[model samples]
Target: MSSLSILLVEDDTIEVMKLNRTISKLNLNHTVIEMKNGELALEYLNGDHKLPDIILLDLNMPKLNGIDFLSILKEDNELKHIPTIILTTSCNQKDLQECYNLGVTGYILKPLRYEEYVTKIEKIVAYWSINELIQKK
Candidate 1:
C-alpha cells in the first residue's frame, strides 16, 4: 500500500507520544503532521503544502475547537472534500451528533488502554485505506 499522510490535531502531549509509538509498532507506511489546536491545523491545510489523505481531530482545544474547525472546513468548498475523523475523549452524545452533523467521516472515543487505542487507530487506518481503494474501482 502507498504511504498515507495524516493530519492529527491534538493538544495532549501524552496522547501524542502514545500515538506515535503505536503508529511505529503498527508498521503502517504513514506520515503524521501534528498540530496543537484546530487553528494551526487550518493554517496548515490552507497553506501551499499538500493536503493529507485524512485528519484525526480532537474536540477540546485551546484555540479553535474541533466543532468550530469542522464548521469552517465544511463551509469552504475547496476544503470540504478531505475526510476527517473525530478522535476525542468526549463520549457525549451531543458532541458526537454535532461532529456528525458537521460532516465528520468517523468518530472514535479515546480509549484508556494503550492496546485498545492502538487497535482502534489501526482499524480506522485500515478502513480509510481500503475505502479509497474501493472508490477507485
Candidate 2:
C-alpha cells in the first residue's frame, strides 16, 4: 500500500512531537503535513498541492478553531468528501455533538498516558490505511 498522506492541524508543539514519534513507531512511512492552525491549513489546501488522504484536526486552535474549519471544509464542494478525524483533549459533549454534526469521521480523546495515546493513533492509522477511500476527481 502507498503511504497515506496526512494533514495535521494542531498548535501544541509537544503534541505534534508526540504524534510524530507515534507515527514513526508504526513504520507506515506515512507523510505528515503539519500546519500550526486551521487558517494555515486552509492556505496549504487552497494552494496547488495534492490533497491529503485524511485530516487530523484539533478543536482548540488560534485564529480558526476546528469547528469553524469543519464548517468551511464541508461547504466547499471539492474538499467536502475527505474524511476528517477529531483528535482533541476536549471531553465536552457539546463539542462532540457539534463535531459529529459537522461531519467528522472519528472523534478521539487525547489520553493522559503516552502509551494509550500511541495506541489510539495506531488504531486510527491502521483502520484508515486498510479501508478503501473514495477518490475525488
Candidate 3:
C-alpha cells in the first residue's frame, strides 16, 4: 500500500506518546501530522502543507473541539471530502449523533488497555492505508 499522510488532532501529551509508540509498533509507513487542537488543525489544513489522506480526531480539547472542527470541515468545499475518523473515549450518545450529523467517516472508542489501543490503531491504519482514497492534491 502507498504511504499516507495522516492528520491527528489531539490534546493529551501522554496519548500522543502512546499513539506514536503504537504507530511505530504497527510498522506502517505513514506520516503523522500532529495538532493540539481543532483550531490548529484548521490552520494546518488551510496552509500550504500537503493534504492528509485521513484525519484521526479527538473529541474533548481545550480549544476548538472535534465537533466544531467537523462542522467546519464538513462545510468546506475543498476539505469536506477528506475522510475524518473520530478516536475518542467518550461514549455519549450526543457525541455520536453530533459527529454523524457533521459527517465523520467513522468513530472509534479508545480502549483502556495499551495492547487493545495498539490493535485498534493497527486496524485503523491498515484499513485507511489500503482503502482507495480521494486525492485532492
Candidate 4:
C-alpha cells in the first residue's frame, strides 16, 4: 500500500507517543502529523498544506472536542470528503451514536493492551492506504 498522510488530533503526551511507537514498530511508512487539540487540527486543515488522507481523532480535548470538530469539518466544502476516524478511549454509547450521526468514517476504541493497539493501528493504516483517496486541488 502507498504511504498515507495521517492527521492525529490528540492531547495526551503518552497517547501521542504510543501511536508513534506503534507506527514505527509496524514498519509502515505513513506520515503522521500530530496536533495537540482539535483547534490546532482545524488550523492545520485550513492552512496551505496538503490535506491528510485520513484523520485519527480523540474525543476528549481541551479546545474544540472531536465531536464539535467533526461537525465543523463535515460542513466544509473542501474538507468534508477526507475520511475521519475516531481513535478514542471512550466507550460511551452516546458518544458513539453522536459521532456516527455527525458522519465519522470509523470509530475505534483504544485498547488497554499494547498488542491490541498495534493490531488496530496496523489495520487502520493498511485499509486507508489501499483505498482510493481524493486529492483536493
Output the lDDT of residue 87, model 1: 94
Q: Supply every candidate's count of residue pairs whose N, Cα or C atoms clash at under 3 angstroms.
A: 0, 0, 0, 0
Q: Rate the local accuracy (lDDT) of all candidates.
A: 0.88, 0.91, 0.91, 0.93
lDDT of 3 by residue, 36-136 (tens): 99999999999998889999999999879999999999999989989999999999999999999989999999999999999899888888877866432
TM-score for each model? 0.94, 0.95, 0.95, 0.96
Candidate 4 structure quality by residue, lDDT tens digits, 1-137: 78889999999999999999999999999889999998999999999999999999999999799999999999999998899999999999999999999999999999999999999999999998888663332
Q: lDDT at 20 for candidate 4?
A: 93
Alpha-carbon RMSD to native, per candidate: 1.8, 1.5, 1.4, 1.5
Better of 2 and 4 by lDDT: 4
Alpha-carbon error at 133 in model 2, in Å?
0.8
Q: What local lDDT does model 1 show for residue 77?
A: 95
Q: Is candidate 1 or 2 superior in TM-score?
A: 2
Please report how far candidate 4 places residue 134 from its true position, in Å.
5.7
Superposed model 4: Cα runs more than 4 Å off: 134-137
Best by TM-score: 4
| Candidate no. 1 TM-score | 0.94
Error of 2 at 19 (Å): 0.7
